[model samples]
Target: MIILKYIFKFYIPCILLITAVTVVLCVRKPYKKQTVNRVVFNERYFRKISGTEKEKYLDSIVTSLNDERNDSVSRDLYLKAGEEYYYLNNIRKSFTSSQIALNLSREAKDSSRIAKSLYFIGDCYENSQKDSAYYYYLQAQKIYTLINDYEKLGRMHFNKAYVLFYDGNFVECEIELTKGLNYLKNSDNEKLLYSCNTLMGNCLEKLFMYEQALKYHQYALGNLKEMKKNNLDSDEVNNFNVSSVINICNLYDLKGEYSKSIKELNAVLTKDLKKKWPRLYANVLSNLAYSKMKNKEYKNVEFMFLESLRIVDSLDYRSDAIYKKIYLGEFYLAQKDTLMSLKTLKEAYRSAVEMKNTNEILRTLRLLTKIDNRKKVFYANRYIDMIDSINSIRSKISNKYARIEYETITVEDENKILTKKNFYILIFSFAAFLILLSIFGFVYLKYKNKELKFVKQQQNDSDEIYQLLSEQNEIINKAKEEEKNKIARELHDGVMNKLYGVRMNLGFFNTKLDDKSIEKRKEYILELQNIENEIRTISHDLSRDSFLEGSDFNTLLSNLIANQKGLSRARFKYIIEENFDWEQVQNIYKINVYRIIQEAVLNIHKYSRALNAEVKIQLSEDKILKLSILDDGIGFDINTVKKGIGLSNIKERANSLKGNLDILSGIGKGTEIIVMFDITR
Candidate 1:
């Protein structure tokens, strides 16, 4: 009733104005100048129409505006058309119209409008063309930054965070996404605030922070609903609310709560599906299929998948279709139709690879293995191979994330320190202000005999600031010394113990005599040989330089290989790509790279197996060094490998040098290690 009232109220005035104009023209046969004014006034009245009539009114306005060469009117009409197409999920057309709007905006030299248009263009490709979306988002972010429009910048960051999520850098992505949310928290921009909240919720859900995820999703939903209630004509509010539902549904699905996911999805279906939001419809259908499959409703699953595919195909959604095929392959595999499963899975894999969708590629590979057990051993072997390959990639990402986190934490810590410093400075300044105020007051009060009290208060405040500064300095010094001591203890206890054993073994061999018998002579000879190897090993361990001061690049590597002698069952080999003198490589990069490899090898020896191992280093044309340590043994799942102390240490060391490390391994196969870094002497 309210919607109808709104429509009628807006249109009735336009109709009355048109009728009055007709009456005036028919009754008065206006003078020539008056006729021109009437026509212009009547055309202006037509522009006041609303609802469906408003679209026609705008179109008519656009025609008249174009005839008058009104750039501003044309730009507004283009933006409206683009928005309508976006609402209808005519993404390609929306993109085209937005591009036209962007060109117009650029000509108008309106930076904000250009950024807004670029954001829409980014939205069009965000799901299917991630790289392109990221590029456009970056372009938009640049403009937003130039204009100091932080709200748009935050939205761009949110979009970039999603791209990173798709690229499989979930940790760093979470960081950036959180940064965006933080920005929104300080702003009142409705669109950016809602987007940041929803995307942050998605990120938290992916990280398994379900409760926090729900909170943010609910926050977004509540905000969106409030906005919608006040402004029914707002397409953004409608889309935002629908999107919140979709995100909640996805989160429930990830948590394996199929019923909840279905409930949310069904709610969206009843609300938005019939309202002509086709992309939203497709997304809901895809999610519904996911829940149904999870619930083992295979027949219904296939139906939903097909429905999603049909809709997405109609829209030429190449990536969406590929994903649906991935789901279908999963469904077929569940039904034990191996041939169909293999065919569908292979197609999905190819498409994903072509699109450079690493996550999808991993999924398809996993499903493909289930389709044919005859290929099981082969696939398992390859899966192990992929484990290493994927692990290496994952390791690089992990290191990147760790570095990002470390840098973030460092910045935060530094900020905290700075904040403390600022607080002290503020305290000092405030005390100074108070003292000056007191002095002024004292001078004024000297006439009234109150100077003593004011002077005493000033002294007390100044003393308090001085005391606070002293305490903070003492605390900082103590912390620094404690941290240094902790590091020293770790090195002494961990590495020194091993070195002492080597020394003891050498000492034992030095005392043994060979004069007793032939057997005694032979035993002594073997003992001496063992002692010599021990001495060499110890020398390698002790001779290595610190990462802080850097090591001799060539010697750092040779020492690494020699330390492997401690592992009884392993045989080691080294392959350096270049014949150039190892001294040419910088010391700073070599030690850290070697330590990363050392840590990986140590993990392998302790957990993988004492078996055949290989270390290869290649210096590429770009001065990029690739180092790998591979071992043939029982390899564990890299995905399941938690960032333990050793792995964390490895990653931290690698990150300090801005290098990359990759670990690949699986059960009964071998572990492959790869590290890459640039060398700067």
Candidate 2:
């Protein structure tokens, strides 16, 4: 009555608006861009429609939109039509419409629509062909993941898990169900959550985790109970509630709590389960009887089992009948009727083998092997072969699932470019051209200002370095002046005195041509050689290279390390290659190199906390001047390290010389800063 009232309430208003909407739609453009979201003139109103008349109405709109003339509009309409058809239980048309939508979406290269289409198609295939359903679900899942559509992604997971559960891949089913719960827990997907939790419980029960399975089943029951009647059908909720009770009862029985199992089972028996769902009615009867037998409440247990078996057989549920038979076999064996138990079990085993039910077959085989000693070896061999085959099948299925589920998808990055037909517009758009030109000019000027500011700052840093170098040069010039004066004094005091004595001796030898005078002349020549040696030493000092090369460069590096070694606890090592000729480089390049090394050493001393440091300067035969500063200390993450003046100066100097600089560091991994200046550059 309520559903009829709802339909009447909505139908009259829609009937009143039909003519007006049709007139407007006929006059208006049917396939505009925004019309896709709207899908049809009355799409928003039909979103919750459930009546057969509304379904026909939606089908008519889809048929009329066969020549919509817009790819995206057609795709959207088809996808919406697919959804509507699905809710109306039109499986064939739903699959066909969704397939059309997928083709159109792919033609337009629409990723989200393609995923949506696949989801509907998978839903259509879920019952008919489970493997095909899983394949589509996996494809849809990857696309949903790529698009970050979590709700749909979670739905896909539950769908795939449902397939795996039915296929008896319980462990993998449990894994997927857990993931589904995580994704849907905070969402308004109570129904899917209930279903996945139920399956997860079933998986745990199959895995022999009785307590855990009981917890999940309870959680599923809670979800169903807490859900609103409008969100979930009352009858459906009642069905799930009774199903949860049956599961809980079985689990309790398995855990050796038969009293609790019987109590819960009795609670749901008041529902009209026998008439509404005879299958579940049979299951409850079977579970209750089994629990009673286990609890030693043997009265009426056999009658209850026979009644459940009668219902199962009437329904033609082979698996359920076989299970009831096995339960009867166990009951008879407990009552010491060995012949009847063996006969009942053999019947179960024969049917299970015929049906290819591995779980039941194993159950039957185990009991037969335990009691039927004459055929024990045969049952044992069959059980072993079955176990081996199951193992092999499970291994292959797991590998196949991994390959399908974990495969990476590469989405296209291509964009559809609109064809340019307005050739005159580009030529005649003088105002737009001016606007673009103005934007370019503004950007260029702004960039130029930043560049000028950076250059000015660099120049200032270079000036500071130049001033320091100049001060050092002044001190060296002063020392050179002092040395020159000392050399002049040495010439006047030592060399001139020796020369005067030699001249006097020579003059004496000129006056007397005797043998004693000749001996004195030989002594005068020896004194001249000594004065020549003193003059050569002073000239060598005057002619020493002032440019930073060889010993000069070595002196600079030593002084830098010597200066920093006291401020830091770092033990410094400087390695200078033997064939490195610094004179081939110019003063400006050499100055930058010196400043780079100096700043790097200063930074290391301040922040490196290094126990050992190495400064290696080498020049390869190809004229690549390499400077490396290494330290064994706590390093820094380059992405996070704040560049201070010392490091900045090193970078600026290296940049000025057109060098490639690399500062490699990691926390506790030490730091290595390398700069290589290509002399060719």
Candidate 3:
């Protein structure tokens, strides 16, 4: 019995322990084998895959490594898949794969891979989602900058600027392009540099900076010419050359040199760009047709338009087709073929609406209103509403651009300050070292050190003064440019459009001079009188010196109010503190105050639907200038309604003058704006 108990306890426990160890080993052996098999399979798969099989091979690898812990290999596989998908034009898949790669790279803390993945994702969305593309590009730019990857950084900036240009944000686009050019100054990427210059030219063209635009375009063209001379010719280089020619032609067209535009387009047409680059070729043809139309070569205009349309249709270029249809409609209208014109225009309008092209829709609507008088009122109302909405959106874009410019300038100024400080520190450190050496060598060196210190101090002072002068000059130049733009807009929208209306009315009156000729003549006389009043109002607004030379502050306010009353339906009243001396206020302060009031009144006239408005100006005994504008209009909710360009301008003017502005308004009530400035400050 004792032997049996010992055997059962000791031997049985030993057998159970051995069996547990065997079971654990047996379970781990298959896992190890599976891992080894997977690695070998991945290796074999990669080796067997051809370049054309990259996407398929990548997919298999990704699936096999989905639960694997090797992040580096996984991220690389995802990146390859993304690149292959991008080339295949599967942007959604490309974006998804790149995003996965980006996340994996981030987890791995791989900056280079992160940047590459971000750039790939940006490219995938560049055409469809501009804002998202810009976001990713900026993210990639930060990584590139951190890594000091200047080439990729320059490319990122260039890409972001292209998207901005597409959004019509030319100011910010130019800023970004300028930054890219600075980074690419010594880079050997001639193609990227050429692209940067070309895009900069386009931005400048849109901003109406034509001289600079032409210079940039010429620079790009010269680069291409140099590349050609070096036998570095490819389809891409040839296409760039063709595009540069087209851009120059478009610039010429914008500048009203239609003959030069046509000549350049003809030169482009001589190259056989049709087969290799059909879209570009079609664009050139359409531009050529438009230039010919503008030059009044009516004989070839229809044929050119038709040929361009045919090419566009063959390529299934819907956007270009929409514009082409509009051109055809215009051509038929000019030829007095009302039936064909209506047909083409309706089709164009439908296409534009479907495409969500606001500019084309507006153009089509206006043309329809002119062609079909039965629907004139309907189309005219739509046109006006669209114009207003477009204007509002453009105003917001301009504000955003100004903010970007200001922020860029601020950063530049800070960098300059930092650089100047570092330079001074170096000089001072050197001087101190020299003083220490002199202390050990010669007693006369003390005076020499003092002289050096004084010289350095003088140089620093001079540099500071120069910097200040430069900053002031920049501010003045910016102000001048803004004023010029404002004047141009006023002339174009207010004066020019009115004059065009007068001309059209005169044309109609001249055509219909039957029994109602006298009544029509009377109406024409009244329109001329209205035009004269408008001209007078503009003259008064521009006549600032006359009001400021010796006139009282009340007189200036009175003149502005009178101009508004003449130009608008709103009644205006002015109340001013007696015995206030406007001449005591600084010229700068007075100018900004005048502008603020002018902008506020204009807003009231344009948007407030106000019947009566009042202005109050007071100079307190403590030399505080107080100005208030009260309008009995259909007021807006100040908290809910975003400020428009006019209100923003008023606020900016107030800030420039070191004033406090308070705007109070509520729906169904009235708006009251009050501004206060301490002239003593």
- Estimate, for each residue in 1-681, the C-alpha lDDT of model 3 and write its tens digit: 685456555654554465456546754633332232242235566557775676676567667656666456667878877887787777887888898888889877899999999999989988998777887788798899999999999999999899889887888899999999999988877888899999999899988788899999998987787777767867778899889988898889887789999888888785468877888888888889888887878877888888889988988888899988898898888889999999999999999999899879999998999998788889878997898898788787665534554665688689998997875565445445445433322233346667988999999999999999999999999988977775654554355545654565566567676868667657667877877776676555654343356666567668667655434568999888877777677876776677677777777877788889998888874578999999999899886898877787778778766788999988879899999998976
* lDDT, model 1: 0.69
Candidate 1 per-residue lDDT over residues 530-612, each given as its tens digit: 55664554445443343324545666566667656645477777777657456766665655666566666667667776478
RMSD of each: 18.7, 29.8, 22.5
- lDDT: worst 10-residue window of model 2: 410-419
Q: What lDDT does the true structure give each of the candidates? A: 0.69, 0.78, 0.79
Top candidate, metric TM-score = 3
Task: Quantify how close model 3 is to the true structure by its C-alpha RMSD in Å.
Answer: 22.5
Residue pair clashes in candidate 2: none
TM-score of each: 0.42, 0.50, 0.54
* Candidates ranked by lDDT: 3, 2, 1
List where candidate 1 sits over 4 angstroms from the true fold: 1-183, 186-192, 204-214, 231-246, 256-325, 331-340, 343-359, 373-681
Q: Comparing candidate 2 with candidate 3, which one achieves the higher TM-score?
A: 3
Give the alpha carbon lDDT tens digit for every residue of 550-619 in model 2.
Answer: 5576676676565443345788898888877766776667666766666676567667899999989888
What are the per-model numbers of colliding residue pairs? 3, 0, 0
